[model samples]
Target: MIQKTLYLLLFFSSFSFSQFDDLDLTPADSLMQEGKIKDAIIEFETNYQKGNRDTNYLYNYACALAEDSQFDKSFAILRESLDLEIKLNPLFDPDFLNLRTDKRWNSFEDELISKIELEYKTIIVDKEYAKKLWKMRALDQAYYFQIHLAERKIGKNTTVVNTLWKVKNNINKENLEKLEKLIQQKGFPKKSLVGNNAVQAAFLIIQHADLQTQKKYVSTIEDLCKKKEADSQSFAYLYDRIEISEGRPQKYGTQVKYNKENQQYELYPLVDKEKVDFWRKEIGLSPINEYLSGYGIKI
Candidate 1:
């Protein structure tokens, strides 16, 4: 019974972690981008009233309210966010500046600090230090995607080639070295040794590694999944990467290119076009249409 309870907590925490982080800007998000704070607040606050639980939406709604000088109401919404245990750091946010003059701000920040400590304690759910390394790699993967996406955007502004990508590339290389040493000393950080979520993070980072680097760990990754140490999702992604690199069509349509003008995603070559969905289903992936929905591609 105790073991079952721990598994339940781990599952819930991992699910919440994944759900909140996979965010893309919505219409309300665009409103915030365009500085239409009131309109954005109206849209976000309406969702909140209907019991929307997305942390980004809640925090942005609070910020929009603050921008509209709705200090008291913003405080109310922010407090609700605290009940959700969302990561709200007051110091870095300019939106909360006006509320800082109020005495309530001090107490609110203290409550936040306590929650933040508790949150970390929860994330460190696994006893193995490999979970910590995987978390670092997960962060690196996220940062890598952000840098890559931002660099892609820089081209539209007619700037000299984006230099930050070079810096980020260097950082990735450094992380690669760190991971290499870790793998040599400890072997592939199988999700079985840590928590499933930690191995999920590890697989995510492995996806971002160079093709040769991926090749080195592919067998171990496959072996672990066979033993129930890792899930098939990352294996599908990693195998697809290898297939494409070797000049073969990928069984999984994990690779895609976006056509900005048409707002559609063009899938990479498939080993068997008609059988693509079959392979995806076998590996526990959603159908291509469902997967591409997040990219704003039309089905």
Candidate 2:
């Protein structure tokens, strides 16, 4: 179970991204998640037309095309995604299973891997630490893919869900301990020191940590953001996480609560609903609506 999760979820975390500053495609993402392939394609194309060229968005668009058995179209989009420097590995992604049967798949896969390797070669510092951070990220998200399955197969309050959370909590605690020690030794990994992917992993470890840990490192993250060493979206999410944890309304609507009764997601309280986008724009984040749409969430 753990190995499967790692393989399947690894692509989602393998690359740290800067392209997320573009418009959000949550509506399309939600449609794809529900297997509404045609709707998702339409939504994705609309977002693409509107200038949402983020590699993650393109990857999902390609997946929707593949799910619809539009291999040629999907491959074209995958090529476009590669041009955008997508870090996802299609070999392990179940969404591209159908594409594997195509004669063009092997060559495309080789090209994709080669390009990914070429990009990785650009990481001049902390290569080993970056690899370690990627593994940490893999562990951080490894069990999340099973939570919904557990909830559906049994129930949210069942031992299955409890065990998943317990395991994830343990992983988070362990990652946090390692991260703090790294910070003490290396003074927080930045892009120049450890490359963007590793820095992103470090940020994610802190983001997944407990409230006290977040509070302790929030200023450090903010400092990194100010120096342009970290992505503002990271700080935005962490800021909202800290706010929501402290019982204060979030400023950027980056935090959401899953309403299991409705089987939907809803944003946490916002500090100012009207000016939220302004605040988000100030920090290089997408508007709250665009951000919420990715989660199928509404204001």
Each candidate structure's count of clashing pairs? 0, 2
Question: Taking the tens digit of each residue's C-alpha lDDT, what string does model 1 give over 30-93?
Answer: 6655456678888987888889976556666776676677878888877776576556343334
What TM-score goes with each of the models?
0.58, 0.61
Q: Give the poorly placed runs of model 2, Cα more than 4 Å off.
A: 1-121, 260-264, 294-299
Per TM-score, the best of the predicted structures is: 2
Candidate 2 global Cα RMSD: 9.7
Instruction: Name the lDDT of candidate 1.
Output: 0.60
How does each model score on lDDT? 0.60, 0.68
Q: What lDDT score is found at residue 47 in candidate 2?
A: 85
lDDT of 2 by residue, 63-118 (tens): 77887899999998878876876464554454665677789976775565456657
